[model samples]
Target chain A: MPAEPARRPTLDRVLRIDQATYDAIVEHARRDHPVEACGMVAGPLGSDRPVRLIEMVNAAGSPTFYEYDSTDLLRLYRELDDRDEEPVVIYHSHTATEAYPSVTDINLASEPGAHYVLVSTQEHGNNAGPVEFRSYRIIDGVVTEEEVTIAAAVDTNDAAEEHS
Target chain B: MAIEVRIPTILRTYTGGEKAVNADSAGAGTLSALIDSLEANHPGIKDRLIDGEDLRRFVNIYINDEDVRFIGSLEAALSDGDQVVILPAVAGGAR
Candidate 1:
């Protein structure tokens, strides 16, 4: 019998985001530098792809902390539910730290299925320099760093065709 | 009274994978009482929802789209068919 070919490994741990969303997230971080920007990218329920980016206001409005406005949070979730979508990526910025999950981030992580993307504006402070962009899966207080693949266009083959 | 409690994805394990569950609301119409009734049906869930008589700092609970904090925290009143949604605050920082 002929030898069977080895199966290719799936890139489940990698976050495959689109170029436009990526640029927008970086822009948001820069625009709100020193106050910590926050937002969510939502996609179809059960689909790992992040197709929509919704920038959120940092209710804390502080240099060291960021929180989505409570009213906005509820409205966002309701909107997602109405669209039959889920938060595929919950992203935030770190003004003075590296692109990594802080202790508070790990403790407050409630969405185990989301890709926690952290953008650090420390090096540039909204300037035209490189910023650290990283992704992680924080579940049950454990942080697992993941690969991030920024594609010119994310695959939308599995997306629903129509919305009511 | 039947109060619908919406559970966030991470806490669905305590609810046997139910997106929403029914909790008894026949007694005093307080959020605390609703949580206690929920804990009775789903063991080990109140701890995640409450801490030492207050809602956990990171946990956000809303009644009929109104934040519990504005309504009265644990003392927030409830009525039959009032939607109770619980979501952990999406928050963090550079520190």
Candidate 2:
């Protein structure tokens, strides 16, 4: 038999967060000086998972940190399950570095259902606005970054266009 | 009862910059209580370990390096020398 065909993602809608939510996340990330910051986005349950909120989670991070905790992921899952919602995507911020996945990051994403969204807050020793939003997916231990297109919170288009 | 708690890198800030914090004995002997004692002394570190009553989304507390989800969560017990390490959910590009 030929190799298994690729499964195209059917992402019909993308949800954006208001300025308030954005500020909340940035503040949270800044509070944790050196280690990485993590959180999630969610909205009304539907065919298109709406990720509209960013909840800053806590971690046991050290200066030489490698991995992030998954306790909050489980709690998010349970909360959504109880509220009759679903996980649209998973998000985290890189405070001291670009919003890209490190080597350890790829090795840890065993789940394919969630999309990893990274925010490049790298200051490069200078202060500037957050650069961009990047995304990724890990399959069979291989990681592939995806491009995400951000739009107005009320825009018909989603924050992401396609998956690679 | 004296218990040994394994601390993950992410939350080391709260334990006075120590890699691992040992308690002669934890208060309630539960994960929540363990964190509570840590936060009470750390002053504002609780927000980093938990979000409200729920543990932070990206972190995990393993009893002896095994996933607590597959076992038991906050209710997971502690012995005289049990080890609890906190971990976070991380993902990314090719190495």
Candidate 3:
């Protein structure tokens, strides 16, 4: 008998995001090229679907760094709490690199429950061209790349209906 | 003198998965005192929230609607019924 392959079963580690939201993220990244753009997509707690996209200002305003304005961060959490939602997706962009998490990104990833999305505009800055969009799970200093599915319609769990 | 401290998702483990916990004996005086009181109950959490004497640069703490950094940092005043929210900064970089 052949030795069993030392591999874990391929579970469905995918990010099912909507087309409009996806476009918005790309657009935001393009607009903030050279200066990183960051945002969040909030959804009902436990719902893996990213339904709402909220663009945030990069307080650092640096070409290679991004940080949500401190005041805005607080308000965003309050809004999420009011709607019984969570940051299902936390996204940012890279101006001159590929769509991948940098060392700083991995170290600063605090939301283990969120899908970390990275959009790279290095190919075409603020213009129409192929952009690299990717997603990952960064938890406890570990990075696991995941597949991103652009769904025309997202079907969140039952909890999503309560708010809608 | 109870101060309700809201724990972010990352720090929930120290809080036993609690979203919010009341620091009853936190001496309704200053933010630093409240943290000490919390440390007494939840071991190893203070280290995550505070680096040496100052708050970790990436960790954000808001007392009511005001950020602790603007108020007075560790010495920020606290009172009953003030909602203390602790949120790690949503930040990263390309380099």
Candidate 4:
């Protein structure tokens, strides 16, 4: 018998974020320039879709570090739990670094199921032209970059009318 | 009853590769006690989670999705069926 090839483990590494949600994240990052901005997006449990955008404060208020206010985080989690939702996407911005998870960021990823999004405002200020946005899945101390697709929100009423 | 402790990938080696472990509070019912029991079962795991008396600066511990830092840290109370999660902070920059 021939030797069998080793199969690589597969992970959920693709993120589909709506255009509006994407823009809001960028705006938040720009608004908190020189200081890291951190927040999360909530959605129905088990749904990979990110529907709610939460703009959180940078408790650390440092360009190199960011932490969520403990009380606010607790309140948010409790609210989401009551509504049967979870943080589908946890995002933060890098003011002076690239859109990648730093060693510190990798260490702080608590939600293995949530997509970790990073936006870098280093090259261009929020008022300037370009920004670097990226997403990744940090599981078991491993970081894997993923594809981000900006999807357009579908209007259910418009769709129904067109079909009619 | 045993509390569930979710271990991060970097520290799985201490748990014999188990992603999560059920730890008995042994009637202490406190976060610190829970950690002590965990160390008793999985030797050397306490050092990774704690440095001296306080949690390592880079490590974040959460109880049922709430950060322990804000809830009295190691002194936080624990209840049956509570979930404890340990994660390292991730920051991107020059090594």
Candidate 5:
């Protein structure tokens, strides 16, 4: 009998965000109506937790595309490096589309470890009834949708009590 | 020591599946020169990154997290311990 081929390694495919972080991302998306908004959340190196929310300007300023200002990106990276932090979450908003990674997004994802978050504000403008918010992992030119867990402290405590 | 160039997943085929490779830029310090050196070490890799003396429209090159396009494109300078990253342009979040 022939031996079975080795299985490919699986990529990390889950993202956890707190309520405040989630709300901030949505608000930034809504504020930049029509044009796309992009930003990053930094965390201590090797810690997957995203603690800092950074709002970035859409250099492209286009509805269909987004690009971080090269200068700003460089400065931000340098600062992160100095502080022993890394971009744990890189996010963007799609005004007229669902929250999903586009072909270009998968192509440009350089930080394989960071959670790529996408928010859609197509239905409502600031006054939200329904908005699409999702997270993904893009590694090796492949995109994998991941489960997003809202980590509210009160909710966690309540869930813990129920479990106990 | 040579500068390290990170090869994207789509371009790894040309590098024999190597994720990163080192290229000496002692004689030439510009990004263009480093790319030429990379091509010399790994044939057919330059074609994916360059077209008619210009980088492909969809390709993005970054050195130490700073985009080369904003600095000087192909003329961006290099130094020891510098890291280079190449990626394709992603667009269209629209429905």
Candidate 6:
């Protein structure tokens, strides 16, 4: 029998958010604007539900800048590994801004893979819907929009409850 | 209409009330020219996004977030539906 060829790896989608997640992220950004909001998007093994924000990290604003804490990022990555789920997408909110990357955001686009999603929010408002949820792939500082596969409700709440 | 170009928040005040603006052009398309046209219309956006040296080391432009620097700098091709997003070096965490 002939040996089979290895499958090519596909890039994970950043996911399109539903009303629930839209609410969760917007609320998170509103509660902590002027600063930045951070979180991880995860899914079950080989899931097609797209990437979902299973958890969030707040209090990112230090001296008027919302920075994704490296420690929090490490913790999230570790949790995803433990769950046997893949970390497909990484998202952040641009409070008082647009879906475009900022001067600071550009400098930090160092992660090799993983779709980067930006939720540009209203200058000020809690219930304000996101101005836009756009996706990007930044490799060596060049960015291009990739097709994001959005899953409806990939809930890890059950797992969270069980683990908690 | 030629093509509508949208400026990000940080670059908006430069455009003056015009978040999305139209660009008049020739077939000559280069990152440098596109920016010159934008600067002509918006006045100060190019300066903020670029410095005299190169695109500000901090600013990243996505011909949809793919990073123009790695692709072709300012020479990246432009399509009708293409959306360009610019973000600063927003790096941080909880403290």
Model 3: how far residue A100 lies from native, Å? 0.9
**Per-residue alpha-carbon lDDT of model 5 for B10-80, expressed as tens digits?**
68878898978999775778999999899998999899899998988767789988789878999898988
User: Taking the tens digit of each residue's C-alpha lDDT, what string does model 3 give over B2-80?
Assistant: 8889999999999999999988535659999899888889998899999988999999999997899999999999888
When summed lDDT is taken over every stretch of 10 residues in candidate 5 chain A, the lowest stretch is A1-10
Q: On residues B1-95, what C-alpha lDDT tens digit does candidate 4 reach at each position? A: 69999886568889998979999888888889999999999999999889899988767788988889889999998999999877665333212
Q: What value of lDDT does candidate 6 attain over all alpha carbons?
A: 0.57
In candidate 6 the C-alpha lDDT for residue A144 amounts to 60
By descending lDDT, how would the candidates be arranged? 1, 3, 4, 5, 6, 2
For each candidate, how many residue pairs have backbone atoms clashing (under 3 Å)? 0, 28, 0, 15, 1, 31
Model 5 regions lying over 4 Å from their true place: A1-12, A153-164, B1-23, B26-29, B39-52, B58-72, B75-92
DockQ result, candidate 1: 0.82
The Cα error of candidate 6 at residue A31, in Å, is 2.5
The docking quality of candidate 6, as DockQ, is: 0.08
Which clashing pairs does model 5 show?
A: A104-B90
In model 5, the Cα lDDT at residue A127 comes to 69
**What is the C-alpha lDDT profile of model 6 across B3-93, one tens digit per residue?**
4565544456676756577664345555566677778877767887787858875566655545677778777766655555554433532
TM-score of chain B of each: 0.96, 0.74, 0.94, 0.94, 0.91, 0.74
Better of 3 and 5 by TM-score: 3
TM-score of chain A of each: 0.89, 0.63, 0.90, 0.86, 0.84, 0.65
TM-score of 2: 0.48
All DockQ scores? 0.82, 0.17, 0.90, 0.19, 0.24, 0.08
Residues A60-157, candidate 2: write the lDDT tens digits. 46422434345554455447556655445566656555665665565556445456666655563124465445656655555456545444453324
Off by over 4 Å in 4: A1-12, A154-164, B1-30, B38-49, B58-95
lDDT, residue A159, model 1 = 38
Which is the leading candidate under DockQ?
3
TM-score of each: 0.93, 0.48, 0.93, 0.69, 0.71, 0.47
Of 1 and 5, the candidate ahead on lDDT is 1
Worst 10 residues of 3 chain A by lDDT: A1-10
